[model samples]
Target: MRVTDLTLGILTLLGGIAIYLSAMNFQAIPGQEYGAGTMPRAVAFVTGLTGLYMIVEAIMSGNRGIGFRFAEWTRSGAALARVATVLLLILGYILVSPIVGFVPTTIVVLVVAMLTLGTRLVPAVIVSVVATIVIQQSFGKLLLVPLPRSDFLSFLW
Candidate 1:
């Protein structure tokens, strides 16, 4: 599916606004000058600016077709299924991660997403496992973020 720049810009602008609003709720650390919302607010500002630029450009170009147009690929059930599966996988990960642990949840989500995108099974599993470990190490060790751990597989962490 092809969306007009105006449509995308509007959506992006709204998303940025929502992110900014949500980030405002982040609590400030006692001795820190910059709080958790700092980075997100900055990113939201930039995203909002980018969306504004896109909207202006779209209007200036005067070639903005209907808000969105469907491409030939949209008619393919397989293509639609792939998109839907990815969305569902993300939702599943969010709901299941806390219960099953970040490592297993992320690995499963990645493997399914890769396979849905036509990656081979073995390669998908390998990449998913490797990527999950990298992410776990980066967040849990390097960044000092505590990820949920599964009681059944605590050794994995």
Candidate 2:
């Protein structure tokens, strides 16, 4: 389905408002002018401005038909299946990650996603492993965020 610019603009504006409100709750950084919320607030401000511009442009265009339109892809079974597969994959990742640990779960999910999207097994495996490690290191080490860990994979830690 295709949404009209006005509808999308309104949604974006609401999302920006929500983000800005949530960011307001972030604690201020000690001796720092900007806290963690600073970047989020800035991004939300830009998003809100963009949404307002879209809303204005849509209003000025004089194209007031419907808020949304059904697209041809909605009738395609293959297209729908691909979308469902992606969604199911995300659900599976969310459900399994804590139990299986981030590295293994991510690698498995990536490999399956790549294979389903027609990538060769060897390349998918290689890419999944490398990408998982990079993501783990980036978030767990560089960002100082703790990721789910497995006792069996303690060597990686």
After aligning candidate 1 to the native by TM-score, how far in Å is the CA of 136 from where it should be? 0.5
The count of residue-pair clashes in candidate 1 stands at 0
Clashes of each: 0, 0
lDDT of 1 by residue, 1-157 (tens): 7898899988888888988999998877778867888999999999889888888888889956547889998899999999899889989988999888898898889999998888999999999988988888889879988898876446656
C-alpha TM-score for every candidate? 0.56, 0.56
lDDT of 1: 0.86
Candidate 1 residue pairs in clash (backbone atoms < 3 Å) = none
Candidate 2 at residue 148, lDDT? 88
Displacement of the residue 23 alpha carbon in candidate 1, Å: 21
What lDDT tens digits, residue by residue, belong to model 2 across residues 21-45?
9999887799987899999999999
